[model samples]
Target chain A: MAEEAAVGCARPTGGPVGEENQNETLQSQETLKEERSMIKVGQKAPDFIAPGYHKGAFVNVKLSDYLGKWVLLCFYPGDFTFV
Target chain B: MSIDSMFVHKMWNDHELEHMVKGGIPYPMLSDAGGKVGTVYGVYDENAGVEARGRFIIDPDGVVQGYEVLTPPVGRNVNETFRQLQAFQLVRETKGGEATPSGWRPGKKTLKPGINLVGKVWKEWKTTDAFD
Candidate 1:
């Protein structure tokens, strides 16, 4: 998913970090696996806090931050992988 | 949102900035590598390990008003998305007094949604209307 998301929008940062980063990402995925659920229309969308890339900087953004404004939650596969 | 890390996003932006003289990614691309965000939106293909392209329009009250998920092979049109947004806003502002017809644009005539409008849209909207 990470690779696919990358390809949908921006290219990958560099070549590859190493084993440590891979393990870390996998670990996070494992932790989130249990929380997956089907979100429904008219239901309250889940709130999330994640790092976002904007204007060449990494900013910590949260879904709650856009409370009063309409939000277009777009999800892509990876940064640089094939779409 | 994407599954790539912030580091990768930064790199992508840097590359785009260097190469593309005009226009960059306008919105903040959230990183959901853990797949948490995708899971919530139900766009994550757990086995395929990728999120099918998904677009959700959330109202100010945090409700999911509209959404669509397409296969990864296809891309979405930004102009259409913006048009949809405007339609939603227009309807909301009018307090359901009017509704945008198909191919509706800003400043165009809008239909008055009601039981009578179900089949008489063509008659209600004249040929001169932009939707026609």
Candidate 2:
């Protein structure tokens, strides 16, 4: 569980660190830190109404539709691994 | 977790859906194709046209209870969601009777209510008399 929590916490901070040299590491670290600070806990999740390809057709789904259920909204960098 | 070509292709494919369904992903995995959800979630990369790996547990009331936004390399744990859900359920059901500590499990010890009971509760954890 601790490992899992560490994985969660490390998600936002584990950008290119070891691969880079000292100078590049410092620059990348500052940029990543700035990006992380943008998302704060306790803030309202931004709502959206968009075309979702669920079941078969591209149905319009809105954030408001999930008002009564626990929505695990996750975002991956790309379809594969370029992050 | 990479979310690059392979990840995106897998997620958007029928095989991946079947795999996730078999793997017991109870919740829906909505795609942020245009990066709208990702942008709103603050995980969107404009240059790459993709979202950063991010996870948020939004309660029934639409408030975010747990939020985790990771860089691209790491994967998320499905168990933490269950743990959080359990913790939230326990607190909601029990009202203010107890509070969950870090890494709290369902049947494990919880902090008891009261003023003077604080020190005593911590000290008398081994004793059954600590709980009211």
Top-TM-score candidate index: 1
Candidate 2 chain A weakest lDDT stretch, 10 residues: A5-14
Candidate 1 docks at the CAPRI level of: acceptable
lDDT for model 2, please.
Answer: 0.61
Ten-residue stretch with the least lDDT total in model 2 chain B? B1-10
Over the stretch B82-132, how does candidate 2's per-residue lDDT look in tens digits? 887788767767885777776576787877778868678556356443343
Model 1: per-residue Cα lDDT over B46-126, one tens digit each: 656667789999988888878888887678888888988899989889988988877688878788988988888888776
Span of 10 residues, lowest total lDDT, candidate 1 chain B = B15-24
Model 2 over residues A1-83: C-alpha lDDT tens digits?
33553322222323433564879669977876666445556567668765444544445567778888777777775442323
What lDDT is reached at residue B48 by model 1? 60
The docking category that best describes candidate 2 is acceptable
| Native contacts recovered by model 2 | 0.58
Tens-place lDDT digits, model 1, residues A1-83:
44543333323244345566777789888866776656888788888899888876778898888989999988876765454
